[model samples]
Target: MGVAKKSIEEIVQAIGGKENINKASHCVTRLRFSLKDESVVDTETLEEVDLVKGSFSANGQYQVIIGQGTVDKAYKVLLEVTGLQESSKAEVKDEANEKLNPFQKLVKLLGDIFIPILPAIVTAGLLLGLNNILIGEGVFYDGKSVIDVHTQWKGFSEIVNLIANTAFTFLPGLIGWSAVKRFGGSPLLGIVLGLMLIHPNLMNANEALQQDVLPQWDLFGLGVNQIGYQGQVLPVLFAAWLLAFLEKWLRKIVPDSIQLLVVAPVALLVTGFAAFIFIGPVMLTVGTAVTDGVMAIFGNLGGAAGFIYAGINSLLVVTGMHHPFIALDLQLIAAVGMTYLWPVRVMSNIAQGSAALAMMFVTKKKTLKGTALTSSISAFLGVTEPAMFGINIRFKFPFVFAMIGAAFAGMIVAMNNVEGTIGIGGLPAFLNISPNFWSVYFLATVMAIVIPFILTLVYAKVKHKDL
Candidate 1:
């Protein structure tokens, strides 16, 4: 038989056909599709198609790994040839209405409530960590030493320092306002709830409760713990949303004569107490349980978890799942008081950066060399996508070596129980280390750089048969 000429339709038909394509999704550099059966697909011919980078199966799904800047075109071509429009349209619609979806709406609400305030929180955490370092070094007398510049700055620095140092002090108020905003409730109500948590009388009551010097509740049966909501999530947000709904419903039923005063008080009182007594505690318990479970896993896995974290993290960055993980880490820090994630992440970034640097060094092709150089710089600055998609994953061997190196180094760091004092990680982490851990921190940072360099060098030599 002579060579067969095939139209796009025929080509698509030969490769499992459009009908066999069950579902499809795209990330930064791949068109991931779920097919009815892998046997129906023609992988060899599909790889030969122009603009196709590579193809593979992962997570029980057939994936066509396109290169950067080509996934959209590939997806469009697939859509046209397959005559599949419904799933694509639904995806678009979902993207558009993501903020309105229940789970997504809550997430968005929480994000909006928390993100604007995150800089302040991170600053507070840094200040606290720095203070600890100072005290440990005998540079400061105590956590509250007025002589400390971090606490005693006269003018502008004083204002900035106050804001940073006082976050935990004012957390309840901040959380309350954010929660109210998130739930479309009265901001004043949130302020009131927050005040109850932070008031001196409440603190005294809490102390009394702790000592068992007083009964759990007064005449109102409101316990001290029930009202102490600071650095807390879930409960306050849920309560605020519940209040918003109740307020609106109550307004609908009240008579126009005394609607303003009567309905408002009743709604606020009912929702506030219910939230304080029931919803707040319930959500607090759930949040605490989640934190405990995560801590347990991390504690159990110890160093080995670092290797798994590093390997999977590189894959996540390559495939665009890394952003969600970043969000989760930030939330974990906020909710759980600290994190063990940054060291592994720092190693992974350095590994990818080193791989890009290696490619720049070895490649004779000017285009590849230039791409690698630029991506390497970006990776150093903590933007790893270009390096990951453009240089590392495209080369394959470098990416694998980078991940392996990262895992090894990350495991070593985790095994030492090394903790990052600062909220940020990656290259910036260098500036954020506590003075007490300076030696360990410096060693970890250097290892992050060195491990990847050596691994990439070895891999490049093995692959190209030349150093």
Candidate 2:
């Protein structure tokens, strides 16, 4: 219990104490501290605090990257020990506006855009896995494939699909809603806009691209393609931002007497035209280019790309900026039938779990050990933030070891050419794996876990006199 408190106090003191602090806030895995002055920050000492995985300055704030679950505890203590009032994320953002570089602002924007729809995405992923599990030749507890052996269960399966499809099929609408709300527009309006993008009359974006379904509308005087953004991500997010801008401007220009009637209508018409004409087509190109680049790296560079991907995947998880890549994953699956990223994701998640578990055995501190055990389980279950920020990350060696573990796992997976056909990753995501590649994936998972655990355990024993 006191371990977290002790850690929080050390964190506060090492960051130049209460007087240097201007504001403090936190996200899923980082304690965001806005210091009155950055020069006073003791980065060296902050690193030495065993509870802190690492510290870095970003977005005009001195962000101490901590993991989930335990972060909440540390945050409360951060306020209490510093004797400072807790601050809202918005307040912290406003004060630290000067601190945010373009990259940091982009990161913050991504967090805003994705956080709202993350649950839906994760749920959709799990549902995808569940659907795969229930229908496959390797279906848990049965030897039957859904199509061949479980034909009678088609009715039940359709119901399952209905439940599953709700999120993924209408993903654009969901993203639209989330993005619109994030941009300070009416959430309902955003959702309505989103659903409108997928109206039955319009041609689906994927279908139009594939030419399997013909376009319903071609612009009268221009050659621009017109299609609905069904599963397209960037188009909708960009659309939401554009919608907010238009809506706000309309509110300013339109009179109150007829504002309700004309404002939404004009905003949607102009925004929709812009979206279908330019934003949708342009971002779709960007998405394609990114997908090609990621695939080329993995395809051409092999193990090197794997090593890089696996290592950075953990860091991306740190900042909650992994959402953008979800679009890439979808594209990869569409292009190559399997995404190389999922295998690395599995390695990153499992290795963190392994390191946290290793910490449990080697650390003499009871609270950290207990937290390690709990967080390790959480990591294994596909939530890495707790194990990462709390245990593996705090003990710097564990995080490094986990990175090493991910690198080696990536190498093995790449060499084996492991891939997943679905938009899922982490532990049970292997459940979504096709039958032929299971053995290779199993070995990669083992490598990811065992290597990091042993390395971190050895480092702990060599360094800790208490152990």
Candidate 3:
């Protein structure tokens, strides 16, 4: 997967050289550059660079499309040659915010905050799936949970559950750490600050809501309610960013003599109190409203929502906005024990693959046919970027058919009331499928694959002969 040094140098030269770049970053499938001047970029020459599948300008960044299989190799080379500091997607969001509208910026912020902590949540989700298999009724224990038949394994199961529950249980701390890290503050201090929000001494927010037992605290003549921040998103993100902003400000103004001791403690106390009295309640309410609103749209509209969502899902992927939905899907799973969003993702990926496969079969040029074959194979294996920028989107018409395939299949799944279990939204979803929905899921997936393949293949056949 190592890209040639010459190719890396060529890519760097083609993007108006290192001097024209403000910052450099990488997502799962693209090397993103924030250039000082967009006009200096030679798009034609850059696309000709070896190992560079494609390039495009979006959200104020010049993004060179790199395949997932070789992105790391190429990203490292770009970093070395450009001497650009390594940065996370969150950091890049800030660098590229000039091109985003206010709403897009807000969504980017949420995605940036959550993306850093996703590995933990995703690992926990997989563990939850494993736990469900053992303890869920009629799953793997022959009509009884595994622990019921084998009492000796109860402690082991408890340990596993504990491991599985850690991320959700202490979500605030992870969010805090990630937010501060994004803000260029010490992640450790932010984590400590976050843990304080969910301290055991405070009344559990969710439990209090469920049982109607919120204990009120009086502070500064205000009746403040105690609410633990576990399993909460907005509170921690706000608090962490607040802490970082305050700490940075204080460090600038505070005398150097007493800075270290005074800066951290004062920042923590002020930020923590502000979070409790202001940000926590406000963010909680906002999060609830947004979640409820989205749920309502999906609930009332059903198939229409699914059609729109699945249809545009690939476009989101291409623009790198899809990362935001990772948290949204997890939130849905938390709320309803499953998600409709993820199953459609599987369909979208299959549709993309189908389009790529169709292009491979119909292209007259042997070179393009080989490229399409590689991308299609990767797409089928649950990596769609190759099929996307590398084949379908590049061909133009195939991408359209892919979206159509996803939309119709998504509508079908929604009409059948298909419910997807909690898991990664790709192939691993099969392991987490809800009972009785497997056949519906499979048939819908087949529809996604077949429709795009046939439509795109027909179009390509006529176009290739003309070519």
Q: Which candidate comes out best when scored by TM-score? A: 2
Candidate 2 structure quality by residue, lDDT tens digits, 135-200: 667544456676566578777767776776677678778878888888887787788888878888
Candidate achieving the largest lDDT? 3
True-structure RMSD for candidate 3: 4.0
Candidate 1 lDDT over 1-467, as tens digits, reads 11122434444664688787666666667676666667888866775554454465533445565556666666666666677663552353234333244654444455556665667666775665544453444334533333354543334444545655576566666767767766666777776766655555443322333454443455365453524555555566677677677767877888889887876688678876776568866776676676667566668886788778876788765443454443345435546545667656777887788888888878776766776787787777766766776667766877887788778777776666565533444566543444445566567667767776777767677777542
Over 4 Å off in model 2, which ranges? Answer: 1-12, 25-32, 42-86, 138-147, 212-220, 319-321, 330-338, 415-417, 421-426, 463-467
Alpha-carbon shift of residue 321 in model 2 (angstroms): 4.7
Q: Residue 426, candidate 3: how far off, in angstroms?
A: 2.2
* lDDT, candidates in the order shown: 0.62, 0.76, 0.78
Estimate candidate 3's alpha-carbon lDDT, on a 0 to 1 scale: 0.78
Query: In angstroms, how far off is 106's CA in candidate 2?
Result: 1.1
Question: In candidate 1, how many Å is residue 267 off?
Answer: 5.9
Model 3 TM-score relative to the real fold: 0.83
Ordered list by lDDT, greatest first: 3, 2, 1
